[model samples]
Target: MGLLLSGVLVWQASNAAFVGVTSNANNSWSAGTVNLTNDSGGTPMFHVTQMVPGQSGSRCIEITSASSVPVDVKFYTDVTALPVDDIRPYIDITVEDGTGGTFASCAGFTPSGGTEFTGTLQNLTTTRTTYANGLGPWALDGTPPDKLSFRISWQFHADAPPVAQAGSTPNVAFIWEAQS
Candidate 1:
C-alpha cells in the first residue's frame, strides 16, 4: 500500500510546486549584473588643505575599515576629469611621529565603497593657483621616497592607517608645493 501511494503522489504534480520554481527562475533573470570595461586617461586635478589634530596622534580625519580599494595619487584640474593635469599651487606634508618630530607619514587613501566620507581630500580645497596642494620638503631615511608640500592631504584606505597616530599632530609636518 505504501508503494502504491508513493507512485500516485509522483504521478500527480502540485500547482504550488510549479509556481514556486517558476517564480525563482524569473527572479534570477532580473538579478544579473551588467559587466563592461572602458578605459581612458587625462590630466587629474585636485586641491589640498590641512588636517586638524587629534588625540594621542590620530587626526580629525577618519576612514572606514575593511575596504579593498587602493588609494593612489593622481593630479587633476577638475574633480570629474579623468587623469586631470595642470594643478597649480599644491602642497606636500612631512609627518612626524611623537618620537621627536621627524617621521614621514605617507597617508594613503582609497574610495569608501558606497559609503559617504565627510572629508574627502579631493573636495576639501579649490584654489587653483593659491591653493594648498604642494608637498613642503622631505628627506628619506627609510624605505619609501619622501616628499614635502603646501597643503595637507591624507590618503587612507581600509587597511593602512596614517603614521602620526602615536605622537603629536605637529610631528607630521607639511612641506608644501610638489611639482609632478
Candidate 2:
C-alpha cells in the first residue's frame, strides 16, 4: 500500500511541473575596413621636360577614402633616391587643399583654408617626413564621401646655383595614406 501511495505521489509531482526552453542562434561578428584611392588612374601627376630655373607649374589630384570606419588621411613624399647633386633646395612648392580636381586637370579646383605648405622642397622633406608629421591628419568619419583635392604648385628658384643648372632633380613620389 505504501509503495502504491509513493508511486502515485511521484506521478502527480512529475505531471504538475512546467518546463520552458529557449535558444539564440547564429551569433557572429565582423570587422570594418579602410580603403583609400585617388583620381590619378595610375598616372604621374606632373611630367615636365626641361624644367628650367624660374619656371613654374601646378597640378591637382583628388584623394578619397572608402572606409567603413573613421580614419585620418595624410600626404607625404617617399624615398626619392636622391643622387649626389640633388637639387631639392632650389625648388619651392606650395601645397593647397580644398575640393574639386583630378590628376589630369585642375579645372574645377578651388583653394580653401590656409595653404597646406609653402616652402622649399628641402624644408618640406625635413618637416613632413612621415604620417606622424605629414601634411595633414584630416580626421574623417569616412562617411558622406570623404574627399579632398591637393594642388602642388612648384617654382624652380630663379637664383638656383650653377651646380643645379643642368642637374636633374631626383624623381619624387607623392603618397597618400588613410588610417583608422
Candidate 3:
C-alpha cells in the first residue's frame, strides 16, 4: 500500500509540471473621409465691372478631391442680388470642362457640345447641375490627385437692346457641394 501511494503522488507531481506561454495582441481602426476644394482664393468666381455688348468673358476653377473616399460633386448658383437693369434675360451663360489654363486665360477649355446653358443668367441661378458625380476614392499613394477643371463663360448678346442694360449684376454666387 505504501508503494502504491508513493507512485500515485509521483504521477500527480509530474502532471503539474506542464508549462505554457501567453502573449497579447492589439490593433485600431478609424473612419474614412471625403474632402473638396476649389481654386477661387477667397473671392467670388466672376467679377465683371464693365461688360459691353458682343463681348464675352470666362473664368476657370480647378476642383480637387483631397479625400480618401469617393464622392459626388454638385454645382449651383445663387443670385444674391439681381441686376438693376434686369439684364439677366439678355446675358447668356455657359459652363464647360476646361482644356487647360487659369481664370485669366481659359483658351484651352472645350464646350460641352451644346450641352451648355444658352438661356439667361436668371435661369442659371435657379437651376442646380451635377458637375461631377461618383468621382473617386482618391489615392493616398499620391498619383495625380482626382481633379476637375471648369470654365464658366458669359456673353452680353449683341442682339440685346444696348439702352436697356446699363447696370451690372454685382452679387452672383456659385456654389459647389460634395457628398460621400
For this target, which candidate reaches the highest TM-score against the unseen true structure?
2
Considering every candidate listed, which one attains the maximal lDDT?
A: 2
Q: What's the true lDDT of residue 119 in model 1?
A: 46
Estimated TM-score per prediction?
0.16, 0.83, 0.67
Q: What are the per-residue Cα lDDT tens digits for candidate 1 across 10-103?
A: 7785534554333334443333221211111211112223322321122212211121222222222223332222211121212222111111
Q: After superposition, how far is residue 121 of candidate 3 from its true place, in Å?
A: 1.0
lDDT of model number 2: 0.85
Per-model lDDT: 0.26, 0.85, 0.65
TM-score of decoy 3: 0.67
TM-score leaderboard ranking: 2, 3, 1
1 versus 2: better lDDT goes to: 2
Candidate 1 deviant stretches above 4 angstroms: 1-100, 104-118, 128-180
Candidate 3 residue-wise lDDT, 1-180, digit = tens: 999999999999889777999887786789767677777777776667677788887788877767676666666665665556777767788766534655556667665344434567767865642344311212232222566667777888888885656766647777666666
What's the distance in Å from true for residue 132, model 1?
9.3
Ranked by TM-score, the better of candidates 1 and 2 is 2
